[model samples]
Target: MDYKCTLDNADSFLNQLKLHRDRKEKVAVLSDLGGWERAEGMIREIVHKAGADYLVLDNGSALDIAKIVAVNGVFKTDCSC
Candidate 1:
């Protein structure tokens, strides 16, 4: 189901600075994934650029930083990777 994420109802608050998560070792790229398979492409880009591991979970899922990673990579991650 399509979801509308706003500041009030966000899984994790994206600070006014738009700091959704710690940009130091993790990066959350909020975007549209036509499908989980399709979204992996974006995940890889994030991983490559951020030089950090990633996770992809349902946007509506809880804010469990421990469970975020790419969803489409061959790494067999739950997100998309």
Candidate 2:
């Protein structure tokens, strides 16, 4: 699903994460190591609070990221497209 980052979509994103958790599915937050640097701590807290995993793509490629997503179930991030 295409998720646009905006205040309106924040709640929806959190809800989606919660839903994934409720289903016993693995939910994660995938980001570049410095993608959300300023808010890294807060982001991790929020994701973990919602029972999701937080991952940083330090030097990983797109394929690596895809592999993680494929194995992890679902991910919610600030990425917009």
Candidate 3:
């Protein structure tokens, strides 16, 4: 899904991605990472540590969409998405 998120806050954005993943929805974050390189790294790290799946895209990259597959024992699903 095309999700719009800002780099002003890393924690909040990561939480949103987790919420989507909990619902078995693959996330493709859309943003301009040209100058927000620091935020980009933080967000990637956060998603990686969560053991969730995600794809970060700027604008020109070719899209490779995939369904969010369920992991055996990832984060518990308590999100109200």
Q: In lDDT terms, which candidate is top? A: 2
List residue ranges in candidate 2 displaced over 4 A: 1-12, 36-81
**Residue lDDT tens for model 3, 1-81:** 843322323123445554554565544333333321111111222223244444443323321112221122122222211
Report the backbone clash tally of model 2: 0
Candidate 2 achieves a global lDDT of: 0.33
Could you tell me which 10 consecutive residues in candidate 3 have the lowest summed lDDT?
36-45
For residue 9, model 2's alpha carbon misses the true position, in angstroms, by 5.6
lDDT of 2 by residue, 1-81 (tens): 954434332333444434554565443444335342111111112233234443322233121222121123233343432
* Superposition TM-score, candidate 2 onto the true structure: 0.29
Alpha carbon RMSD to native, model 1:
13.2
Which stretches in model 3 have alpha-carbon errors above 4 Å? 1-11, 35-81
lDDT of 1 by residue, 1-81 (tens): 943323322232223212322332233333334432222111111121243333333343222222322211112122322
- CA lDDT, every prediction? 0.27, 0.33, 0.31
Query: What RMSD does each model have against the real structure?
Result: 13.2, 10.7, 13.1
